[model samples]
Target chain A: MSEFGSNSENGGRVLSFEREEKCHSAGCLELVVQGKATHYHGPRNVDSLLRAMGENSLYANVRINGDVLDRRDFENVSIKTDDTIDILYFMGGGACST
Target chain B: MFDLTDEEILRYSRHIILSEVGGTGQQKLKEARVLVVGAGGLGSPVLLYLAAAGVGRIGVIEDDVVDVTNLQRQVIHATADVDKPKVHSASETMKQINPLIEVDVYHERLTRDNIFPLLENYDIVVDGVDNFPTRYLINDACVMKKKFLVEGGILRFMGLIMSINGGETACYRCVFEEPPPPGTVPSCAEAGILGAVAGVVGTLQATEVLKIITGVGEPLFNRLLQFDAEGLRFHEVNARRNPKCPVCGENPTITELIEYAYTCETQAPGSS
Candidate 1:
């Protein structure tokens, strides 16, 4: 499995569609990513959203509308406009030991 | 019922005036026992505030001593305390703030053998340690003992705070599983943190402890609050308890506390 895939055996999978739909249209979906709202253009998935946020690793968990996104769905799961995505960066140093 | 004397009543009048923390809540604060794990930058504000707020018993565990350099952020210590043990200096300040409260000083580092005994009597554990190994040890110990822990971390201009109610809430392990590889993350010594940032994070930690003691506001349970002092932005992210968390999860793997190898630079003779 790729590094971006779930490490557990119970990992879920996202099936791909034959024809992709564009996320940018007259009625394009808007997403609140990391507290900032942005217009989402073409079939936005977790991977695309993460990329747009300059995040490359799947080590962090992505929450959509208060639910954790399954790692397997990163590439296939479609994100709708108005959805709130919160990316938790758990590794940043916060402990104050000097 | 915990009775407050005339002096006590006047001392904590501000807290008692709050509807959430009336006379009853003030009494609760007087009965709460909180153990703070560090006496440096973060521990300074935590100990001072807990003392000022009338936490009945506050135990501070710190093995280092005050240094002239520490005065930049370890506000609880003064130039006169430069050579004194951190816990001693901190406890002295705490008492000066509120002689009505009791301050216990432990001039020792937190290790696997002493952690449980040190924390067994306290109602809550506040993490102000600046290293990964000790941080992980505290998290695991808190989970094992089912003690509430208010954890905070600060680096450069960023800080994060979370509250863990034993194994019930999302634990430190539930989110990060393990500490990052040594050398991958910069220590405060290497990265340099703004002195005020420590106050921000440590003060938040003290607030969480007070909230836990009096049951006043919503604690940071099951949530991680991150703040960027430079950008002046705050964000809260949802964190769920992981059943696979080695320390708090069912069918657990970490049955006992295991001390991770310490790789940080050795502290100067009296530097925290």
Candidate 2:
């Protein structure tokens, strides 16, 4: 019973079956390829994912499987093959007209 | 006084046709007073819709002038508006959209000493600002004063929006409590934002405002909506009122407003 309700975790990414084994090198089929945004390597741990994506990790807010993960938890959280990660950072762009 | 004229009736005929927002809802829009802070990216679409929708009286506050860089994402200001004060450019454009609605402009900075008086006349507040300090300030002020606020943020392809009813719903601080300790805060660089991203989030904020004024549909309320444009997906998270929230919690530690200091820009590539 976490704060987040019954909504689909990992955003709306269709879960492509559960991972039976921890497959590291052979490439994970369900990787949410954030291409062009960063030189993304197949990230296993949160730090590697951030490093691969070239994200600063300072103010970047991370959420895995849709649950909000604190900055302190970044080092501890690992990525499974089926996991979906969303990193958000808030900025000041008032009047933010477009 | 909020009655619609023949022209006003004709103008909003489309809105009047919707069963959920007939003549009564249009009238609610006419009588509503909304104060929007920042005339930049997010404020652009919000001002356009609220004015076009015939929101009775709209107040816009801005201390920045229109720049060459802002013309791309800030749709309300024209290329000719480059050197002009943003409040003037925004108000002029809003008036052009709908002369029926009254627009009040404040060409000054919002500060701790002046925010209360600035918020005195408006019923609802909209946060279209681009910095972290002001966002936190606006959130805390609205929470302490018990005002209805529609919060929006966008960067690159990411967009976040939430509606706050002060102490009743979850405030911004309730979910993301870290405002950074003043001097300890480092400079945050801006990543280029897709111009359309602002439009997407700002339009949603405007929709929430219209919904709130008319009492139609579910107004985002305690739900945080995140839009990832790359995936074109919308994710929602339910947030209950945190009983342990510092400002709005049962115990309530923050009785007074606190102003945070930030170095350089807060985050993302946004112009205000």
Candidate 3:
């Protein structure tokens, strides 16, 4: 398993299951993750998505679809497929107010 | 209600015609007092747009003289202004843009001792500074004074903006926590910014200021807006006020202004 709990052994099972459900929902929601199109299997919460995006810092804010996800929901709120996840780092290069 | 002369009506006809910024908004703009911190890249567009919008009292604090290289992005300074005090050049341009508005010039650098007194008189503070030390200083000061601040920064082809309404919104420290270790990040001079990128960010800062002054639109409070000019992508990220924030938190650790060590190597002669 990778640090973020991606199990190599379960990869095949996850893909097979996802493929089987692909016909039902057209690949189970495509995520525009971090400014890129991504395909994720099953429903993932905001925290997992953030970890997948290599965001280890808690100073980040996650947006689901078009709404901002509260910090309390990062671990519990499920993000469906086709949802857009924007993980923005709020630091660096702020010479003024930004 | 402000008594608008016939000339004033014609001068701001476009703004006066807009339903959002009618005569009432124009009056608010005329009564607003805004302070812009820098006169370089980001400060240039911010000062120009705010002046053109006819902000009544605009205070600019800049200690540097105009250099030939600053002309690329510091549009407020002209070719003839080279070597002239940037504050003078900026004030002259602002007056030329709108003779009705008053421009106050502070030909000195902002420091811990002077920041509070200088900022107390302004309704809103617009930060266009180019260094991290001053950025943090301004943030802490604004937080303590309970003032609204419009913050922006630009480097290369990317820019970021945020607005903080005292302790109510997410202050700069709430996001960055603390400035990066000195020498860890490159300065604008070292990284070399695209001149036009500064214009994009500074113009947006001015827009935020106008929104704050007139209450026309929802400012970027508790949110961060980042733009990548290269790909033409914009992202708005929600930010939360940290209860553990050193300066603006419930159990705040920082009660006074603390000046961070300056690491910029290209200092003017005699500057400490």
RMSD in order of candidates: 7.9, 6.9, 7.7
Please, what are the lDDT tens digits per residue for candidate 2 over residues B63-182?
888888887789999999999988899999999999999999988767778789988899899998777677887888999889999999876667889999988898887666666433
- Tens digits of per-residue lDDT, candidate 2, A11-97, equal 422111122233233444234422111112354567666654445565456667656666776777887655656655554432221
Q: List, residue by residue over B1-272, the lDDT tens digit for candidate 3.
A: 66777888999999999999999999999999998988888888999999999899999987889999888888888999999999899899989989999999999888899999998789898888777677888999999999999988776566789999987899988766777545544556555677788888889999999989888989999988887666566766667787878899899998999877666545321110
Instruction: Give the DockQ ranking, best first.
Output: 2, 1, 3
- List where candidate 3 sits over 4 angstroms from the true fold: A1-98, B265-272
The estimated TM-scores of all candidates read: 0.81, 0.80, 0.78
Interface RMS for model 3? 9.5
Best-matching candidate per DockQ: 2
iRMS of every model, one decimal?
Answer: 8.9, 8.5, 9.5
lDDT of 1 by residue, B1-272 (tens): 55999999999999989999999999999989999988988898998899999999999888897878889999999999988998888888888889999888889888989998888789899998887778888999998899999998876677889999987899988777776545556667766879998999899999999999999879999999877665566887778898877888887899989887766447321122
Q: Cα RMSD (Å) between model 3 and the true structure?
A: 7.7
**Index of the highest-lDDT prediction:** 1
TM-score winner: 1
